[model samples]
Target chain A: MAIEVRIPTILRSYTGGAKVVEGSGDTLNDLLTDLDSRHAGLRGRLVTEAGALHRFVNVYVNDEDVRFLGALDAKLSDGDSVTILPAVAGGAFGFAAAAAIAQHNTAAGRRTPVTVG
Target chain B: MLSIDRSIVDAIVAHARRDHPDEACGVVAGPVGSDQPTRHIPMDNAARSMTFYEFDSMEQLRVWREMDDRDEEPIVIYHSHTATEAYPSRTDVSFAGEPGAHYLLVSTREPDTEEIRSFRIVDGVVTEEPVRILDAGVDPHAVQSYMFGQSPATVDYECSGR
Candidate 1:
């Protein structure tokens, strides 16, 4: 049984719209590396140049958070399910409101929110 | 569509209302193994955008660390829609990483009332669920005391013979 990796909507394009894919490895790092080999550029989105999980990215094994389990070094097993998600803070507040805030913040000389791809 | 305490629902609504046109975001932390959404942690929307909301990275780190110390998990991850219905947007769906969490949405578009909804976002699929609002049943004062880390027994006995 291979590890099942679940991809989030934002990252789906890299997976060819695959919601779930299988990879084999003894650890999360190995699994992600294996996945990147098949799906180019996927690792770049999830990991930083320093080989660490992206600040805005989260990975979970089964139902336990990887951060609590050793992050990328967390061990993996066949049949384990992995999920990836971007670290976003809020939701659904209309685009108009966001635009207004962005404009206001820019005018007020505040740090504008990072625009996620 | 998991069952949640009325207080928890109220807190989320109150937060959304308080933030008004700007987006509000937060999480309900529950006992790690139990998955009960009990503790309310209202977060500051760093984006502070009327149309967008994002957690302040520093605040998120602090709150998440506190949850870990308390052996709690974010069972209900929630945010608000100010000018729209209580539904997850495509952006929201894209960020729904917590598969085990109940993604609760509260809309404060109306001045008179709020519209609240819940969904399970798993594998990029949004599944709306029925929210069973639970009556806490416990004495309000006792619950308050307990939340403040005070002994519930003291509050219960001080108020009445139990």
Candidate 2:
């Protein structure tokens, strides 16, 4: 059976304004190759030279992460839905200190002492 | 009808603010339908740009197991935005791992000024919903009153180190 891949707005231009596309495949790798063939610049976004799924690209098979399963080679069955979620990370400020303090307070033996000033 | 204890939202916001500049991620767990706070699965993600968040695989898996052990599914997957609009970006929309998951984004860019928004992202569609605000009342961490076990989330590494 064929699966439907929905394209995000940012990448729609590459798909010629077609957000949702149909293709037939039994695995993520095959589906992705077909998608890249039909649309340019798509493959480069997913895999790197080592043939590993670029860490930036996250794929989900029927809402379950393929990364947790088998990455690109993750198997897909007929009618099974697959989602491609490339890790999108871009922003101005970094949330480092706040995360650290929160963790410290939560860690074993590291209590956040109450302070009054 | 979807009631989330205001305290969980506040604590998540505060935590995000504390990590201003980089991205902060966490998991919100409840009874799938409850008024009281459930659990918070704190995690780390490497910041790439102004509007994208990539979580650590090990951390995410660990939290997933933790949530499973508690017999609760992750109801909300949260992250922070440092410079972009609270609205989900094309990138965020493209890779919505959860079709029925509540996607919450807290903009810590306006550090002193807090702006937090919650969204329901499904199949590339992002819908903004009203998040019932809870009064901070007596405790600064008051919202965290019903917090589950503290999993101790720490940033193993960051690019900017901010």
Candidate 3:
């Protein structure tokens, strides 16, 4: 029931600089809990206070983004591999504009428009 | 200080110009632990906005995996400011998550001139750094001429909103 988790460089400090760590659980949430027990504060960086995945932290279960697979509830099995990557995002806009855009997108009930490249 | 190749700079500027009025974003990967930037990868700006840029999630995943397989890391994370100076905006600082990689900004506000600058944003603090462009035939490892100072070639312009 061992699942391998690949850590991004920015969060490696929590894992004693280990690029890959092993944990076990039936779901992504459980696995993160297991790892957090040893890593300390790592889970806080990936999950928000409301228990949802952080908007800027991307978690992929194997090849699929966990967002499309039930997020924290995403199922996991033995030997599953999870990769955590910090979202590479930004802009030249001011904070007020960003907040306005965010509100507009949320009100429209749509995620930021994305075009696959 | 960020020391990069002239060809790579040209490529980034070209990408920025081609995507004029829209933000362009990309990464330059180098060998693990090597600060030198060698591979230039132009990423799609998913947001595709005049003032914002975000990498396509799937493309980012694939590119990151390829960098991992090649034992490389993102030495430089770059983006263009279509209507502003080559500086990190509040949104840029809030979203900067990479502490080890240089955050490069290219300003295409002026049609005739391109302004480029680099910064290190750690813990929400942005610090500008010098850029040295290595000419072709020059050793990438050897020291080169410093092209820009902290402010770079940015022209004075009035920002409507803070």
Evaluated with DockQ, which candidate comes out highest? 3
lDDT of each: 0.73, 0.59, 0.83
Q: Of models 2 and 3, which has the larger DockQ?
A: 3
What is the TM-score of each predicted model, taking all chains together? 0.61, 0.52, 0.85
Error of 3 at A81 (Å): 0.6
All models, RMSD in angstroms? 11.3, 11.6, 6.1
**Per-residue lDDT of model 1, residues A8-53, tens digit only:** 6567788898978999899888998999999989988888899988
Model 3 misses residue B134 by how many Å?
0.5
Model 3's i-RMS, to one decimal, reads 5.9
Give the top-scoring candidate (TM-score).
3
* Candidate 1 TM-score, C-alpha based: 0.61
DockQ of each: 0.25, 0.12, 0.43
- Candidate 2: segments with Cα more than 4 A from true spot: A1-117, B32-37, B48-50, B135-162
- i-RMS, each model, one decimal: 8.4, 8.7, 5.9
| DockQ-better candidate, 1 vs 2 | 1
Q: Lowest summed lDDT over 10 consecutive residues: which window, candidate 1 chain B?
A: B153-162
Scored by lDDT, the top model is 3
| Model 1 fnat value | 0.47
lDDT of 1 by residue, B15-130 (tens): 77666777888888878767577778877787777677877655665676577678887888889888887888977876666777888888777776667777888878988877
lDDT winner between candidates 1 and 3: 3
